[model samples]
Target chain A: MRKPKLSDEDYPTTGHEWDGIREYDKPMPRWWLWTFYATILFALVYVVFYPAIPLVNGATPGVLGWSTRADLAAEVEAVSLRNADIDQRLLDTPIGDLGADPDLTRYATAGGAAVFRTYCSQCHGAGAQGAKGYPNLQDDDWLWGGDLEAIVLTLKHGIRDDGDDDTRFSQMPAFGDILETGEIDALTQYVLSLSGQDHDADLAAAGPVLFEENCASCHGETGLGEREQGAPNLTDAIWLFGGDAETIGHTITFSRYGMMPAWNTRISEAQIKQVAFYVHQLGGGE
Target chain B: MTDQITEPPRLFEAREPVFPQRISGWYRRLKWRIMLGTLAIYYLTPWIRWDRGANLPDQAVLIDLAHARFYFFWIEIWPHEFYVVAGLLIMAGLGLFLFTAALGRVWCGYACPQTVWTDLFILVERWVEGDRNARIRLLRSPWTLRTARLRATKWTLWLLIALATGGAWVFYFADAPTLLADLVTFRAPFVAYATIGVLTATTFVFGGFLREQVCTYMCPWPRIQAAMMDEDSLTVAYRDWRGEPRGKKHENTSGDCIDCMACVNVCPQGIDIRDGQQVECITCALCIDACDTMMEKIGKPRGLIDYVALSDEPLERAGHPPRSIWSHVLRLRNFIYFGLWTGIGAMLVVALFIRSDFSLAVTPDRNPQFVKLSDGTIRNAYTLKINNQTGFARDFHISIKTDEPLRVDLEGTAELNVTVPPDGVLNTRVYIFAKPEFEANRAETTPVRFWVEERAEAGARTHADTVFTGDTQ
Candidate 1:
């Protein structure tokens, strides 16, 4: 051994001085050096056991062959298996009696809320509050029906869906080709007055007779609407298209055809049932 | 000092083994009692059980990290109520400070696990290898079969103690009986085994081998105590004035100290008490016991090595009476620390007792804010989490108290009645509908209170205030 120890003045330094300040170049502790070497060894071993190096196309597959994607898939599969019993229960439960089982009701509603946000929210609004032309699902008024079974049917076949043979289909002839401009104007005023909107009383005088002859078959004589025929109620403040006279005139001249795609073709049966259950419980189901 | 000495100091100083001579005195007996008392408390605490009904664990003291709860006898702390645990930690710290300022390192000398466990390890060592002189001689002697057998016996005993210490710690985190059964069957969690392994290694190395070095180098409490101490703080110190001017035994010249090394030999720290107060001294007062015994044998007075404040040194040297211990202990700083320590404990107790058995959190739906109904009624949806912390399943009736003619209803149930399980949280939705053209229906948002009342208790009720959104926005 050269020497046991050296005093501070004779200790080795980094050799770069600044303003009479010199840093000591002390040897690292044996334990600390060994820990550093162990860390490097661990990295090397980890690279061989896990995907570590990045390639142009993808990461290099290690011998163990584990991936985060596969891990996530396994977790999802595990959860699916865990809830298989509950999912079966939800499927077997009658749509109308769902409310009787609080557990299934909660499961359906919570699941339906997720399905709604993912698919139905774009058209019907996130809370099923509806946009301009779409029907407000949270209201008691329903063009088709608002009950659980009715909602399920609407979800399965949809309103005016062309692909589904059992789709709720209805059509009103565009009055612009059949009626005079003066008659259509009178009908517009009368339609607005039915909803208690401001209108010219004199122009609306011919509306009741004209509506009874032309619109009373699907729309009731009192204009309360026929749910079996899939017609809307006119007395309510909830308007699907618009309640203004201009929109009403346009509706009379060129009739409205709202299209809702059959959800059964798009989403799973459980998802369809859940979304229906979700809409029914939004304080609107009769 | 290094320049004057011909021999140079090594960069890495090799450790010299400490073999404290076995001695008995008032301090030694007190340490033994404290060690036994503390060890019994540690090893036996997990076996205590208290009933917490069907829904909760019955362990009297458990951290229950899986459930994010702390159960201690009658009180259970929820994750949100972690401030109570923080308050307890603060009280413990302040208590340490108060004791250090008054009596000096009482925690370190008598109560610290390191001190207690190391004392036990040393006792085992003494039994296996004889007393201090014999152990020193064995160290210098060449290895032999008998020596190997003694070493093996001592090490095996130390390992058993270390294993027990580690096993005791794991019991605090889980149910003791169930975990113990699982551990014996080798079905315990990997983390539990890993924790035991790590703790066992640390306890063995720290308590068995590096005993005084831990206090002198690793522990920060003794260094922090330097700031807490003053002239009036009672520390284990030597009255060098009376005992210095050293003379050989029976050839005593002028001082009481006969140059006997009884105080040093019996010291756990292996530090001479006559060298005055040092950081290495745990102030265990073992040296006082050893020196006092020697004094009686030689027909001299005891307390040559005694507990005294630095300020009392001058007064005692002049032959005047030393001040009372109360004068040294009851200072303004110590009283303030004690007041703070007790105040937090009192506040935590009050908080625990006054905590509600049921709680509510109402979150209004942010998706659509408000939905206008067919009859022009404005509706707002809310999700309420009702936490029933009690042991019984509870029925809570939901009602809205508002000036907006708002009607509250629970979805899927017309009666607005909800049953929450014991010690469970119920996540359910609520629908509030306002009358057509109500005053608040014209406004953007209206304030509303959701009252959830337990049906069992006539007056037990809680309310969560939230806003009912309207059509204006």
Candidate 2:
């Protein structure tokens, strides 16, 4: 054994030097060295017990023969087993009665959110806050209706969709050639005036008579827009195209029609119910 | 004269091994009992079966993370009731405070897992390689086949104990019998194996190797316990007033101390009781038992090293009798801590008993606000969520309370009786159609309460208050 009284100068040093400083080759701490070796042993054991080595076909099966896919399947199975009761109850309970039970409502809401994310989020933003032309599900403005049953019907048949016979179909006559340009301008001012927006008073006064004669049958005498006809409320701030005077004049002349695909063939009935339940709760659905 | 310069000692020194000498007395026996009791509870709790009807798990104490439920015998806690777990943790904290204020570090000395497991490892070491002197000699001796064999046997035993400790912990998270079978067959989850491996490594390193270093360096409790304690708190201390002026006993002229170092040898923390209280001292009182035995053998009074309050130390030095242990134990601070601890426990118990098994939550649809049906009646859509928390199936009658006549339609069905499965919820969309006359008289929003009553139980009912949205204008 080396003498304990040896000076630091006598200690072995690495050949490398920086400035005047020389590096001493001291041994690693005993506990740290042991811990490192222990981890290596643990890794070896782990490799033997779990899939580690890669092959042409796949990774090694390992001693335990476990796979991530199998684990995921088991987890998915466990969750489904847990939710089986709620799922059955949801299927049996009337869509209208779903809100009466808190647990079922929560389940439905969550299911609805998942469905919305998969199908509706592309058009209706992730939060169901709509983009232009796509109706915002979270606002108290609906072309058809905001009631649960009305929303469900809209989801099933959709508006002006091609494939479905029961699809909500409405056509506003394009008065571009039928009516004079001056009459269309007067109607725009009258439509703007209904919402109390700033407009030409003389034109609006002349516009109401034309509106009462032409628009009242569909848009309602009060300009509140008939839900049965899918006419948007002229008074509300929400507008699918644009609420400006020029946009209104163009819409009156050429006529505005928005098409939404029927979701009956795209998503399951349960999913439609779930999405309706979810959209209904987005601080919007009546 | 010139003084020779010498290098200063390194501030950080490698850990020195401790060889605590075996000493038997009340404290040691008490420590043994506590260690065995705690170990038994920890190992056997998961194995105890509970009968919670048909669908639930039968573990007496289980934290069912998979199901997001905590089952403790008869009490089944859902994820929403996690406040009960928080209350329990708070009670544990307050309990430690109460005990610490009354008796300093009684938990650390008698009940800490580190101390208990370290004591077990030490006992095993003593059995394999004799007591203190022999173990020290064996360590210092050059490696021989006999010494190597003894060391190997000791390590093997320590590893087994650690393995058992680790294996027992994972059983609490799963079904004990099934998991044990799966583990034996090497078919358990990889995480379970990993958990056991990690726990085994930690238990072995902490209990067998790091022992006292954990209490001194790793743990923060000793530092916090210092703040919890006061002068009146009872702690294992050396009665310096009686044993000071240390020397050989000569008649009544000198102090009774014989200058024996038995107290230091038997100390688990390797602290000298004569140096007053210290952070290193766990207050385990093994030194007291050693000192008492030595004093009795030498025909002197015991209690040379004993539990003494700092407040009593001055009194004893002034030739006055120390206050009784009860006088220190029943202080106002300790009383308050005890009261707070029990008060929370009582509140939790009350909440557990009074909470309803079912609940009704209604969310009225707001989009488009209210729809005007073709018949001119105003209809409001509501999503009702009925939570049935009971274990058995139940039939519920749904009803609504409105100021005026309202037609409630659930999927066009007029019947309000609903049957829900066990431990489930029934979700439904309700369209409440208010008569035009009713909407004309009521405001834009009317107060409506939705109620669900168990068909068999007279008073088992829950109700949610929601607005009856309408187009009043």
Candidate 3:
């Protein structure tokens, strides 16, 4: 090591001084200066290899041609490749027997939740509870059925979806086209009476006869509904749409035909199964 | 002395090397024992075995990062219970404060890892290069084959010690024996090697090269000691009142101090203690031993350089007896710190004993508060998270308590009993349905609580409260 340097008083000072006090003209540490230079060199190298500088059109595509979007795509592609076997296994297994492997059920349920959020939440709900025209999935009332196989079939080919030839096709004729206004009004009261809702008994007296003649084939004699025909059980507290007197009157007059898109066209077969697993575990699965 | 202080650049300066001469004294022996005890504990703690079930780790002290758990013998801390760790850290800080207020800079001198490791490194240096005089001679001399050989031998030993220091640390985070085999076979995780590499480099540099400079310029504790120390605090100081009028031991009118430079020569800090309470003094008491030995040789009383408080200096100058060490230690500041330290410790112990082996959390679905089902019944969906934070796989019977007749159903099973692996967290959906008769008269919001009870221990139960929204219009 060098001998101790000249005293602080003897050392050269910057011209700036306060009273008799003077600041020493000490240079920065050599390592610090070297590190600063290294950072500058790194920045220059980074500009050449990475998309750093922004232009009006977009960022400059450096020689490496790396982009964050491309990077994310690669990462997603890598994960997809890794889970190919798991996805295949989930698709191969029957939906009813998924719970035989609890671990695989868990994986399917978790991945299904992510898929539901991305693809199904818009129409049904984030919680899988359907909105106004859509069905409340958490209830025991299913348009067709609530079992795993039934739900999976419904998911593949949605209700009254025109695009899918094998979709759950059902249509209630508009009573205004076939029946008189007074007859339609009487049928509404009887339909409301079936669920034990408030109704005019005198007007509803003709409901059983009218229901038998027009709606019994699909809605059943007791108005319990036919799942094979996608007719909702009128006696249930849960309703796909509103269950008020006005809504019931309108349903009789105009009929209801709700539409849900076939998910098979939009999501993968494995994703469909995963979402079925997730929805099946949402406390309402049969 | 003030003028001798240099104004080095804020963070960097040319370090002055210190070659502390070899000495033997009561304090040096005590320091040696303490150093050995601390180092032994640090290196061997991971290897100690505690039977915490076969499924869990057997290491007495382990930080299971993968599982996010901290295990210390019989005690286990989940990540959620990190406040206990925080409380321990606060206790450690308070302990340093109490000791510093009572006896200044004692931690820096005796127990600081920097001090202990540097002492060990210096001991190695002495064995290879002789004591202070010989090391200085080698430093001043031109390069020689013997010097090269000795330097290589010394550095090789230092590096080995540093590697061991780092190797011991990695074991704390994993199963020690398993990790050790994996490490030697180069099959260990990348993080373990990275941690060992970083720690090895830091230990080698900080202990071998920096030495006393760490205490003097690098450590923030030395500066913070100003607030901790007071006039009553005992510090290593030269008794200038007795030692003044300094002259040669042969002189007729000389003070007790011989001006022999033994105190200065033996100082690990390379500072003269006679310079009236310098900050560099770690109060290690090596100088007191050196000066006392010289004093006895010169037919004078010991303690020419001694541990004395400034307040006692004036009384001692008037030829009064010094007060007891307890008188300084049992003051108000120390009492407050000690009280706080024990209070937190007591609270932690109470909390640890009172804590249950499991935890429960319930979150109801917000999107649809209630669902009206087919049977004129109202239903609510909830997600329950049950944490089985124990060493053994356990069964938990999950049930609900409410004023209304609410039927609870777990998704996967007919019954509510679930088996959770040791230290596992189970998340499942639960459906709560109101009785059909009570559906019409249900309240807007009914308060309900879900309880998770250990099957083996009936009293071991935890509960979380939530609301059940009305599905009836």
Candidate 4:
């Protein structure tokens, strides 16, 4: 850019001189002056075309007829259209059948992950890492059986729950009244020994007879509880109540009966099956 | 060095008219970029869309005040979670303080709305009426048809920008596209138009007309900033030690300064930096830019006008220059501020973690403590208000437990299965009646527990407790 010459007509001279310093009052460029005018014209056009002046009653709607709500609605409609195919497919196919289709399975898994975060994360931690007293689905152990069919049944019919008829009906008898305190203690030791924990040799020996007479019906000969009856396996390291001697003694004396809530009345069977398959896929199902 | 110092140089200078001559430099470019960036974001953010399923607005950023909902991308904020907004404001304040302590007035100079809009308006003026010199000359010129047209055109552009600025602001409050349409069709709500008008007037007045006067006089930031600044704070400064004993170039050999008044001429705020730091100075470095260009032309050092804190100060006892001011920014005051800021942030996060999903309140019917029913049963009335804070609608079953065999009788619905809309409050009047035998055995006042259980699919349940009061036996 060439510097314009400072002429007396175009430049206004500053009279103040400090150490021979002076300023020229030069006129601004005409192009710059026109741009300012252009901006004003644009503003007027904008006000006339869009919402601008506020009347006593309300704002004056411009001629362009644009609105934020309409824009948002249009955007939402576009997104909904994009997801329409997958959403329709989800509705058409049974949740169980979704497992067979890889694309559907992927979609369901992602959808399940989001649902799990919103609904299941409170009790079962965000990562499905169960806290104390809550069952960890990541492991192979299942109190109500791990098979897809069995899981679906168990979810639909909660254990010992009065609300649903399909509930898994299994209640450990209160041995507190049946067995003597010493006998209960001996059986507790035997149960602990089944998991390979240290136990009193004499007590374990006596517990074998007690186990055969009272517990073997459900626990089986080797103390590996029957899954059909919702009886827990005794050979595994994992314990529902506790593995400690005191806890084992208490379990035998009181007879622990943890309840799994019935979902038939709350959640549909399809949903239960979907959740069951999801839990089975957690990698621990037998 | 041998010259004896009589009195220390005065800390302040008498006010002098700046008359800054405009010049272009790196700092000026940086300011322009920032101003443009901020303006684009402000005007365009309302148009961005986010998918929020059905029955939800898709605007990326929106504040649905009518429904008490705030949408920011994927996160949805409810009125109950207003604490999040409060926490954010606190965080912003602390962040500003920290930034100010480190680089004095950087936010004011580069990022403040006032600075950005004013710069835009100034650009518009420069484009229309020419630069500072041209504008000054035009002001002195006699009134003519061309001059009037130019002036009118400039005002028109300023007004349009102001209107747009105001219009964009209301979009945040409602759905932008629909409101725009409503605005055009003349069907938009009155409040929307009123808000836009107010904003437009303010933008035009503050950004176009008042301009520098707002920053120099009206704004409270200058007063607060004075206290925030320390000697070590990095600020736009003229190196008096180098530029003093000023004289024009090719005339007298004294100091690096050419006595060109370029720095004063270019200043938007019209403040002279050579007169020492003033409260009116926004530290925009425009003056530094003006002086640097003058230095380049005069073959003097560029830093004759530069950003300097107290790093150049000499240690009185040690006889060496003390540590740079930057190191002091990380010292006790800043550390304490940081600690409090983090502490509050952590507390807010913890509070969010512990926040309950359901809120419930129980109020006993004051009219009749206990009514003797026709069937020989005593009845107590209660109003249970339940707040469902979840995203989906929920059905909550209400049950009452007391010493007596009391049965809950909901006034309207037989089943106490109340359906509470998402983020909504549901109020139900419940009547508890006791069998004659049970009521006869009870004391004058009976303690009862009101329980609300949300039975969700997958067996997920949430329970809240309140109390149902009954008259004494």
Candidate lDDT values, in order = 0.86, 0.84, 0.86, 0.74
lDDT of 2 by residue, A69-166 (tens): 99999999999899888888887988889989988888999999999999888888786767667877766688899988998999999999989998
Q: Per-residue CA lDDT of candidate 1, range A1-286, in tens? A: 1133455577667787899978766554344455579999999999999999999999889999999999999999999898788888888988887878978888898899999999889898877888888888887888898888899999999888889988988987799998899999998889888988889999999999999989999889988989998888888777888888998888879998688988888998888888899888876888
Give the alpha carbon lDDT tens digit for every residue of B1-473 in model 1. Answer: 24444444333444556789988999999999999999999999888999999888888999999878788889888887899989989998998889888988888889999999999999999999999999988888999998899899999999999998999899999999999999989999999899999999988988888888889867998999887888888888887888887788668578888887888888888677786777889988888899889889988888888889888888998999899999988889988998899899899989998999889999998867877777778878899999988778999998989985667778745698999998788988898888765877878888999999988757599999999887773
Q: Which docking band does candidate 3 fall into?
A: acceptable
lDDT string, candidate 4, A130-157, tens digits: 5555565555577777766776677677
**TM-score for all models, in order of appearance:** 0.83, 0.73, 0.89, 0.56
TM-score evaluated only on chain B, model 1: 0.95
The TM-score, computed over Cα atoms with residue i paired to residue i, of candidate 3 is 0.89
DockQ, all candidates in order: 0.28, 0.07, 0.38, 0.01
DockQ of 4: 0.01
The 10 consecutive residues of candidate 1 chain B with the worst lDDT sum are B1-10
Model 1 lDDT, residue A204, Cα: 95
Stretch of 10 with least lDDT, candidate 3 chain B: B1-10
For model 3, residues A91-159, the per-residue Cα lDDT tens digits are 788887788997688879889999989988998899888998788777778888888888888889988
